[model samples]
Target: MSNPNEVKSTLKPAYDHVIVGGGVAADKAARAIREEAPDASVLIISDVSDGPLYRPGLSKDLWLKADATLEGIDLGTTETGAELLLGTTVTALDPEAHAVTTSDGQQVGYGRLLLATGAAARHIDTPDDDRIVYYRNADDYRHLRSLVSEGIRVAIVGGGYIASEIAAGLAAAGADVSVHFPDSRLLEQMFPDSITSHLAEVYESKGISLNSGFFLSSIHAGRRLTLESRSGEKVEADVVVLGLGAVPNVQLAEEAGLEMEQGGVSVDETLATSAPDVYAAGDIATFSDPILGRRRVEHMANAERSGDAAGRTMAGTRTEYRYTPLFWSDLFDDGYEALGETRTNHRIEEVWNDAHDAAVLYYLDGDVVRGVLMWNTWGAVPKAREVMQASKEGRLKVSELAGQITPGG
Candidate 1:
């Protein structure tokens, strides 16, 4: 699992902290700038020549753990000495000559950079071939785990959360799964229909195939893989996974002008990036969020707490990054845990248990409490972020967040 084309393409013109990306928020911002500037010279460029990855274990435990190992999610880059230029791809971002312009023309330089160019896997116009598998990263989960055998037939498409955890890791490796989606449930903009009708009756009680409202329209990739939809409904398979979600890499922060938002790359609060010495963390960072305010958080706990607060504010320790992270998933046994903006027009509020299999929803908006899931509820994410920081600060009160975290109230 390491040979992403053998990497290490050489580059050392300059670097005190360069970064750009190599996922897991540039390996936790080059191990938090070598633990706060210890001789600091880190580099980490990465366009996936795969050197340090753990991308949510490429959709949960490399397909539901059977002694999972891609060298066990190796995010080591030689334990943070951070050189790694693997497969490069910076392509220009002068940012006032602090420099950066790879893709081979070379022009390194940097004193403090870091963009964490993470995200990109949301296609779906269809027909691309090799039995189409847009499933992001770890080389599409080792090419769909070398095409699982037992009954094969996959056909995923997007029902969110990486196509429901790659249809529970290709139906626990025996394949013959089938998800499709046009939202009739399955994270319909974030659960609730009482947990999306018990998560579509536990993925149709395991045999899978819940084509829900379909609507994909085209994708015929030869030898086996049809998928028509949009009022037609075809769905053959062999392997077709798209999981349409993730777009953030932000074209090198929109060609280096930086400062964008919502669609990400606007920093501040120490993740810096107005340009001076630059910064920006995980999922192209839109950061802010004192309590779910600004956004852009493609999970993995906001890329290791926004790459250790943008590598300790690019190693000088400015570190602020208000951190409102906390994301989790796993579908088969319904593991959950969430935080902030769980959407679906925001007013949620659950708390179930008796066989609905543990819950605690609560999304609210008028009285604050931005979001909190916890389904299959476990240690209660710091008591649901202290009841969403006391409902974002008015001290609870939306009928007291219904049994607050659902203890015995």
Candidate 2:
């Protein structure tokens, strides 16, 4: 536990590097900074009560366990001797002075600053109630777990990966789960109608209710909440969980007068923001991607890689962040690893296995392969990345890549 009074009294004049967020990106950046500049003083400040942990596990592995304590989830100590100031919020940033003001009214200067502020769960217009949860951190998981019981009705909002994973986990925990989303199918943004239908069937077989194209109209909170949809349909549940997706935490960057693009802090290929001596990474950074142009990646892999690159650059090693991100999610017996952009707008070429239980989908923009989706298949991430790169470089045609990727391969 950190004491605000003590931290303010003993604060140093300045540090070599200061990271503004305590998520995976900050953790990796601290380590990379230590490796590059051993003598540099590093300080990590975050509003999270706990230090960096495996955030993705909160929705998946943690919910499935009978006794899911937040143990063994820490990212572990860094060799950088970085001082951690947890449970503290940054109030303001001064780019010209190369300093930041915290909520405690203490200004800390830094030679190089990193804004890995990440994103927060998007809130909806719902009544205030203990049963209403906007799932984001470990605390949210603990609260939801305590409410899960046999036959407990859980109404989930949004049809993204978080809602899907939580629905599956709640069903396994003996809760009657109902998913309500405006999309016609789950993961509608990532998959086409064909893949969405298959995923819907898997959830339906597990006794989970799939209420698609139902926009939430109103919520009447009580011991049991009554939810009314736009279509005049009513559904009652013991608890309501919102997984409506995340909006990047860019207030600090915006206040500091940093450049913005694509709804996030704009950064160059090296993760350097428009402001001098300041960099942004992870969910808050719309970095210049070597392959995809300027884009913001929300997955954990991108966070780690971009943070490492930013740290190295801050430590005087100029390097470009060119790594491709691979995202994965597990739902019951089915799981997938996807490389590149998985948006459904592109033409998708799918190959099903002989058993009809597995599949691989190649996202093509004309004759070029833009992305790859491995359904119920693992360990094909590297191959998928190779195919995407080859297509981008015009070394392989979509037809040639299609024949090479099989369902099992």
Candidate 3:
């Protein structure tokens, strides 16, 4: 990776397409653009010191292998001829002039622009300390790997998937792990109490202390860090891991006067922003979904498909993004893959196996199936998606759908 500050002179004055992110979305978009127009020049500007790699691996594979280096989890080479400007930050956007200014005061013009800026980890009000870590990028993974040892005390703050995965990983690695969250149950927003209970039990069985219905109020670092809850209860730990959610990186879009929707840059079905020749994809784009209406998806599958669509559209192919995104996570011996919205308030119908080890949950908004969650169940995603599509068109009854997917099947 080239140093953006020192290599300012090496940057080109302009490019046919300029992408301002270095995640999966940017990589896919660059590849699509090259496929559509082989002769066009493409450049990718990213703040990450390393080039594009699988972000999800940082939480799963990298954490599981304490000796794993960032190079070991590389997503392989991007065949796109896009010049990557690593360790670089875009400071200003000039839509009218079709150009952007980097932190080093370098003005680079673009015939077409893409903002796949992704997101940043949300933080809490805890005091600064070497033992405190927010799980987000490659650097965080490396730092946490160094801290995990036999009997090492780890307190994870959050009830989301990241927290669950980290707690499971650390616990399996012989660390004394505890999970603290403000919710009454784990994954409260996505799963009902019944499902969350099963998940919590799994963590408890693995020797992970479950601290529910409380959030960290203060952090005092000393020989061992003391974390006080809002209700005055406390727990001491050697290190703290924050799994708070993320906020989309929308400053560039906001400054450029692009329309915003639901905390992201609003784009049409073709993934084109309001500004001429400008597009947004991945977590930063609040795009129009053919089936789910207007929404922004932060998962990896959505980033890949949406970025490809946006790249094709930018290259004058006039493509429309119309795929449903599915996100999956594995923790210990359990995992789930889900598509569509999985809100807890929805009417749910579930089928559990004889051993209660696997289940399929159907979320309904009125008589329409809004989402499907397959717990420890694989090879059912296609069927689930088909069921949802059919339900949306008022073609399938809930009872008929339930009969199709028995617990054993």
Candidate 4:
């Protein structure tokens, strides 16, 4: 093996496509750019020491599944012939000059720029501490995994999507996980109380503590690790983990004078930003969805699909991103796959089997169906998409949605 002192290669004078932020979206964008323009010089810039990866799996499969390997999550940027500047951040962007300055003080130009600079985790307003983890990425996964041992008390803040997954995965891995969130139930903001209650039961069944209405205000690392919620209640843990949702990394795009909407870079159906030859995808891009209005999807599926579209369009393939992406999550023995908008505010309709183990939930805005959730249901994403399309076309009504898309259908 080469010496550990080996230096990273200097970035080239310029690249045809320079994608900022090394995550799933950037990885997918690089692969698509190479596929469309085989000879294009592509570069991916990421602050993570180990470049792009299947980030979603780090919360579940990489930790719980015996067959899951680190190599399985690798996006293989080298195989795509894309140069990677790892452990580096894009400090500045110059859209007018088609160039970017990185944290390492290297300036590079690009023919076409794709700002796939994903979202950053929202953290408590307390001062930074080593005992805390924002827990948004692969590096965080590795770090947290390293800290896991028998009976280690871990305090996890937030009970939303990533938080719940991390809590269950850690509990399975033998960590004493106590989850704290403002909501009374897990995923209360996304799913209805009944399903979210089911999710809470799943976690409780696994010996994980669910602390509701606990607003974590500050963490003090004393003799043992004291975490105090807003109500003056204090709990001690060995380590603290933050699993709150993410805030889109829009500062770079905003500073470049690119138009922004809905808390992310505003892109057309083609995924092109207002700036010439500049585009954005993944969690940082809020694209106009004909059926769902404008939405910025944070899941991996949207990143992959949007990255593919942005790459092709950047390479002169001009593609419209009409594909509606679906997201899935595995929790204990149950899981969910859903598409379009899923929120607590929408009217929800559920059709369940007699066993109640499988069900399909329809989320509607009045008579218009806007989203679908296949809970513990399998093999019906395509059918669900067709259902949503029918709703979009005005051919389907809310009353006609029962059994439209259900388990194993």
Candidate 5:
């Protein structure tokens, strides 16, 4: 989609590599390139001018108080002394022409291009809706901070991390918060019913409404909106927020003629896109998970790990990106952690209580330790990880592994 002469005129002879997207993945890739290709020039381009900031940690500390600043958090300058292009959005990529253009009409040439565009919060396709806010970036956090003042009634739609974390923060701020989810349990796809119920109990204890198995049908704007559940129940809210998961930012890759699958850029173990001289990682790339034996997309911790690996690989050191999916969440005073993929068939076998602040759920698929759910048990994660690693390697059995890997007394 470019004029031949114009594309030809924009080619630059120098870059060791170029990274598009300014999120965690792009930062990781750039760092890896500098480490491996010490003499090569590297460049990073992104629409967000603030550079790189830790997003997952932001919801916990920064967004809770209205005074936190997000400036100077960018992933520091490139390691190879490469150029940084801030506040620039790449509008088009002409792979055939070996050039990419930004929305502001800046043409960039790259020897190898890494697309780690990441994802944005899913905004519901609603008509005449302006009251609903979805938090994704630093600006969104700041906006929510200002809107949430003190003792405000906040309604969070969707389940999982966003809804849970926002509810926790709002409750801590002395606001009446309601978290609505389409499922009866929190993180239904990842956590078991028992775990979700436990989280619900904790939230309820903190004066937060855990409205699971409910959906928002429509909204009205008058400083309050109406929410209808599938069971015909209704709710009124002061401010509404949606955390309906995320859709991968895949337009740039798709337009460049890179292959994609299951709404993500499909890649092998190496994190290379189907197109030549192109790569992808983070929430936008789907790859085979050796632990689960399936093609999957991990959004948080695993995504960063894989992104770092891809950056290293692009920098000239080749390594496979593989890790069991691990996650943790905090709700008020209670904290929950889980490792590996939970299987429905894995009935909880060994339930243990320790220090009255921790509980462990051991799941077994036949004789294998398929999954684990830990509450207030931050110390046991490492041992559980080891057991899961051994299980993935076909070397551990649930019955025999228990006594060997007992929770810290």
Candidate 6:
């Protein structure tokens, strides 16, 4: 714990470095900075009142299923010696003055600045209903928890990981659950049709309501909110949650005159912005994907990697962001994990169904394996990502790959 009086007295006008944002990227970068520069003064600025929290696991029902004791985030002990400014929201950046203004009117100066502000959840345009909730922070989870105590009904909107996880959580908690989706399948853009079908079947078997091809039009809050769907269907529910998508929080960068494209700050392999002595990372960063060779903004894995890389660079250590993007989601009794970039041209080399409880789907472009998706198979994630990074065509030989199976297979 830091003493407010002591911290305020020793505050430097321009610290050795200053980090913006409090998500995974900001935390990782701060830790890396401490590692490389033990003597340097580092300050982390974040809008989140509760420091940096692990976002990958922050679900809608975070209070119940997860560890409630771990309230927010504490970056262990700052061994490298970094200061944290919790509950601070950065309002503006002055490049010429090398200073950042906060919402509370505190001006922070720095030799080097890092932007890892992350992204914000995309909400739907529905009439405000006391029953309709948009899960974003701890308060949202608390609100949901209060509502769930009475064993009420829930209608989750969207089809992303958050939506799926929320639906699963609500269903598991004994709430009458219904998931509204724009398409006929879940995660239509990310996963193949086969995977989506499998997911739908699993959700259905769990007794969760799966309403596909439905777009929520409005919400009338009461004991049960009335939801009008585009399909002329009305869903009455005690609670409605939106997990549609996310947009990068790049307004600060844009206001600071940093080059932005596609609603995110543009960065190179080093995660450096156009402005000198400044860098950007996390969900708000748009960089050229090494595997796909296209510009993309990946929220989860990319944030940590980019933040660490930027931190090291700012600390005068050489680093580069080499990404083999990986993401995982848990739904019902099953978990799905994807490793590496799956090309459109890649053919399905091997599809092994491990009793449907677990499975691995490998994709190949000719003899070279490009990507792999595992269901309830986390042990293979590290190896799959490693193989993908090691070779352009990763883990290509299906027979050889299958031969090295363990007891589970």
The backbone clash count of each candidate, in order, is 0, 0, 0, 0, 1, 1
Best by lDDT: 2
Error (Å) of candidate 1 at residue 316 is 1.3
- Model 2, stretches more than 4 Å misplaced? 1-9, 78-80
Instruction: Write candidate 4's Cα lDDT for 1-409 as tens digits.
Output: 1122122487698999999888888877888888899999988887777777788888888779878866777776677888888788899999889999988788999999999988989965754666678887766777787788889999988878888888988898889999999988888878887788788787888899999999887888776678888899999998888887899999989988999998999999889999988999999998877667788888889899899899999988999988777999988888889988888789999888878788898888877778889898888888888888888888888778885875534
Candidate 6 weakest lDDT stretch, 10 residues: 1-10
User: What is candidate 5's TM-score against the reference?
Assistant: 0.85
Model 3 lDDT on a 0 to 1 scale: 0.85
Alpha-carbon RMSD, candidate 4: 2.2
Per-residue C-alpha lDDT of model 1 across residues 72-148, encoded as one tens digit per residue:
78766666667787777888888888989888788889988888888889775766676687877777777778877
Model 6 lDDT on a 0 to 1 scale: 0.72
- Give candidate 2's error at residue 130 in angstroms: 1.9
lDDT tens digits by residue: candidate 6, 238-345: 788888777778889998899987778888888888888889988787776666453555557777788889999999997878776677777666676776555334
- Which parts of model 5 have CA positions greater than 4 angstroms off? 1-14, 64-68, 72-74, 77-82, 127-130, 343-350, 354-356, 363-368, 379-382, 392-394
Per-residue error for 256 in candidate 2, Å, reads 0.9
Most accurate candidate by TM-score: 4
Give the per-residue lDDT digits (tens) of candidate 5, residues 77-144. 45436566766788998777667888877787777788888887787765455456787876676667
Residue 391, model 6: lDDT of: 47
Candidate 4: where is the Cα deviation over 4 Å?
A: 1-8
Better candidate number, 1 or 6, judged by lDDT: 1
- Which ranges in model 3 have alpha carbons more than 4 Å from their true place? 1-9, 65-68, 406-409
Q: Which parts of model 6 are misplaced by more than 4 Å?
A: 1-12, 60-68, 72-81, 341-350, 354-356, 363-370, 382-409
lDDT of all predictions: 0.80, 0.86, 0.85, 0.84, 0.71, 0.72
